[model samples]
Each structure stands twice: as structure tokens, then as C-alpha cells.
Target: MLSMAWLASALIGAFSLAVHAEQSHPAGKVHLGASERRADVTGLRPIITWPGSRPAQLGQAPSASTTAAPAPPNFNLNELMRSILFPNANVIFNVQIVDPGEKPKGPPPDIAANFSISGWGDNLYPRWDVVSYGAVGLEESAYLLMKPDRLCQNGKPVPVKREDWIKYVAELSATAKAVYTASLARDRDAVAGLADRLNESCATCHQAYRTG
Candidate 1:
């Protein structure tokens, strides 16, 4: 009876040690009664807790979102105005030059008349290429104007408020789209009317946002 009691006590002590080992190590590790030294395990090492210096928070701060904002364009708003907006708007204006009245003179004989990229003539067909080019340029410029965090050469934000700026850009896009549709339908009068609207939209934006 004494020998049996000693055996039972030893088994209980071993079971307690096994439970203690399991609790101390990370999950998935095999706890053995007797095995090689920990250092002998080829790629295994003790789990490490993060240092007290670091915080173990889950969600990031709200202000951290600003860091993810898209980067501004390489060039400034003024450069974009000069290179893209002005040039493309001029293309539309030149359409009036090429064909002024309902009955414009046919292609200039000796280049005297101001002919535009669209062409110079009283022909029935519209200059689809010229129309498309000008319309697309204006539309794309409007899109750029609406991009976030745009600035002028002097590093100033757009002169107008964000809402107003977006409104103006949308207006410009609408005018250009109307012009494109008119051109597609070969409606010279409608195209001319829309061109005037385009000019107005541009003037409005420049008045509000153009900087020194």
C-alpha cells in the first residue's frame, strides 16, 4: 500500500508540471517530459513580448488619415491654365474665326482668311476632328481643376471655396459636352451657341480663381 501511494503522488506531480509548462509557452508548442535543450531546436526560439516602449493599440488615430491623402500634381494650377486650359479654349474660339457667319467664304484661296484647324469653308459637313479635339481638352481641363489639393504657382490654394470651384468645373464640362454633341449633329448654330457658353464659363472661373 505504501509503494502504490508513492506511485500515485509521483503521477500527480508530473501531471501538474505538464499543465504548468503548457500555460507558460505559446500555443502549438509540444511540451515534453524530457527532451533536447531549447537551444538545440534548429529554428525554434522563445516567444517574445513587445517592449513596454511600444503601444499595442488596435485602431489608428483619426488624424492619421490625412497622411493617406493623394499627392498634389507635379505642376501648379497657373502652369496648367497657361498650357492646357488657355490653349484648348482658344481652339474652340478659332472655330468662330474659321466660319464666322452662316455663309462663310469657302477655303481661303491665298490664305488671306483666318483658317482654323477644323478647316475653312462653308461646306455642309462639320470639322469633326477639330470639334473633338477642342471639346476633349476643355473637358479634361475641368477634370484637372477638380483634383484635390491643387495649388497656384505662388503656393496658394484655389481662390474660390471647394464647393464653388467644383461647381465652376462642372459647368465648364457641361458646356464642352454640349458643344461636342452639337458638333456631332453637324449643327453649326448650336455649336456656336455652346461655344459662347464655354467662353462664359471660362471667364467666370478666371474671374473667381485667377491669381496674379
Candidate 2:
């Protein structure tokens, strides 16, 4: 490699000498100086160049562009509500049926069948069918929680004070909304805590009604 490099350098020097000698005008023009014999320098530049911008680094992120990027995951809000409402449906049921590392009682069904979730016959999950009225029920529960004592006012008898209802519902909604939003924002471990609020609401309702 050393000899080859030396050989290459010698060839280049010889070529440059030949070119310069050819450019000399037969030793004539005794009045012409070396600078005068040179080519025009006004528009000339170094042959090699580089970019003005720096490249992205190893393991470093590129600058974000404002182009059309792939969107965030499309989590269906309706499906999420439905899944929460009926925790025993399809995948949810299968997951709940098994303890950690424990096998389920049966083999897995086809995806087509699994997707077609059906109603449980009994109190296995009462809130399932009634989830269609979720918005109404949630609003009613919010009102009751806000004004619990108002339930028996001027009419039949019930429990709870009016003003405390507002406080209770606000507490539940705020926490649930925050955790659920974080889950939607891609926090993988948020669903369980948010789901706990739902169960807590149900337990409170059951205690209040004596049969929720």
C-alpha cells in the first residue's frame, strides 16, 4: 500500500509537470508573469465542497416536520365506553377468567365469534345492556350525587343531602376523566385505575340503593 501510494503521487506530479510545461508558451512572452499566464480566478472555486446543514446524530432524533404525519392510534371512544360498561365481554371476559399464568377452562374461539359479544343471562353483568342509556344514567347519577338530599324532598323518602351530591360526582368525574385521558394519550397502565372509579361508583350506588 505504501509503495502504491508513492507511485500514485509520482504519477500525479509527473502529469502536473507535463500540463504546466504545455501551458508555458514556448518560453516566449518574456514580459508575461506567472500570474498573467494563469486562468481567470474571478469565478473559480475549490473543486470540493460541503453542505451548510448538519446531519442528524447517531441515536438522536430528527427535527420534526410539519408535513402530514401518521396519526395517533385510533382508539374508538364508543368502543372504549362499551368495553368499560361490559367488562365481561369477549377479550375482557377471557382475560378476567384466568389468574396470572393460569389456563382458561376452554380453548380460544374464532375471532369472528369472539367479536360478536352477547348478553349475559342474569346479574352476571347487569350494567351491560343498560350502557346504551349511559349518558342519561351518568347525568342522573351526577345530579343525585350533587344533590342527594333532594331525592326525598317534597315527595317520597330517600337518603343523602342535596349539596353533597355535586361534590361526590365531581370527585368521581374529575379523577376518571384525568386518568382516562392519560390512557388515551398512550399511557399503557392507566386503564385499571380509571376502571376502579367505575367500580367504586357502582359500589356506592349499590350501598345507596341496597340493590344496584
Candidate 3:
């Protein structure tokens, strides 16, 4: 039996193809004589229109001469750093003390206990999802931080010209990914060490960028 996700994807693809077919040739008829159609597992046939015909509209809107209004920029560096990156990074960092290899210790202290993430689930992985989220956020945020036109909240631009900033951000991303990898492997020492590496990266960048 097909999963709900697969079924949803198939339905969406079919609907998209149907819309394209309707828009391309005419109201009722679809002209695929000069077009190529491909069959997939979903049993939906993709339609490709011929040259010199009206082009099919896909994800983007079909435009002739009108210019679309510019989208307002939503996020600046300070906001993103504070709102998204900081909390997520802390989640992964918090688990640094856990030693997966050691025999089960007695109940953890109230502040340090793993509650719902107790490794008693059917999959038996403890808080793997949370660790993965932090890893992905760190890796992705590095790329976003380097976006050409990103600004700080005070209207100053990110220091793209500073080589050290770039290098440190890259290091942070790499170390976060390494931490994530170790977490997935349940390697306690590796995760602990790499989390420290991530901290070093953060400190170096803050020294260069953060104002007193």
C-alpha cells in the first residue's frame, strides 16, 4: 500500500499536469503530437509542449511585459542569529554530557533529565530528531549568513569583505555537521568534542563581529 505522502505527491503531480495541458493548447483539446510525455510510477503522464506554441505555465507565473513588485526582505542577520540559530544550537550542545556507551546511570537530575526522549520508543533512538534539527539549522544558517545582500538590524551590511568572518562561519557549519554526524552514530565522545569545536567557531566569529 502506498503511504499518504506518496499518494499526496501523486495527486499533486497529476493536478499540475492537467492544469498545464488545459492551459497550453485550447479549452478542451491537448496537443501533444510534437510534445514528449513521460510515464512514472504514479501513472501520471507528464506533458511537454512543442516549440513555437504557447509555453506551459509551471511553478512560476507566465509573464509577458509586466514587472512583479519587489518582495520585502523579512530577515536581517541579528534577527536570524537571535531567533533561529541560537536556540537550536543550544539543543545539540546540551546533550554533550550524555555517554551512550556507558551503562545506565541512575535517574538524571531534575534539570538534566531526558523526559519524552527516553530511548523507549519503538525505534529506540533518543532525541535523534532534535539533534538532526540543530545540525540542519546550523548548516543552512551558514549559507544564509553569506547571502550577498543580507543586513544587520541597524542597516549595516554583513561584512562580506572580511575573510575571517567567512572562514569562521564555514568552520561553525562544518563543526555543527560533524557533531550531528556523531550524534546520529550515537558516538558520545565525538559529539561532545565536536560541540566544543562549534563553540570555538561561535566565539571567533563573535570576537570579530560583535560590538561591545
Name the top lDDT candidate: 3
Instruction: Give one digit per residue, the lDDT tens place, for model 1 in 1-212.
Output: 45757755865686677567646853323333135553356365444447774443333353575568677777888888889878778767766666523454586355335433233222222345456557778887886877767788779875445778878888988888777666656566777777788888888877886656
Task: Report the lDDT of model 1 for residue 130.
Answer: 54
In model 3, the Cα lDDT at residue 159 comes to 79
Sort the candidates on TM-score, descending order.
Answer: 3, 1, 2
Query: In candidate 2, what are the lDDT values of residues 26-95, reduced to their tens digit?
Result: 2212223357545445345434333875553443444577346654323332332344433422222222
The backbone clash count of each candidate, in order, is 0, 9, 0
lDDT of prediction 2? 0.40
Alpha-carbon runs more than 4 Å astray in model 2: 1-161, 209-212
* Alpha-carbon TM-score of each model against the true structure: 0.53, 0.29, 0.58
Candidate 3 overall lDDT versus native? 0.67
| Candidate 2: 10-residue stretch with minimal lDDT | 123-132
> Sorted on lDDT, highest at the top, how do the candidates line up?
3, 1, 2
Deviation in Å, model 3, residue 170 alpha carbon: 1.1
Cα error of candidate 2 at position 75, Å: 31
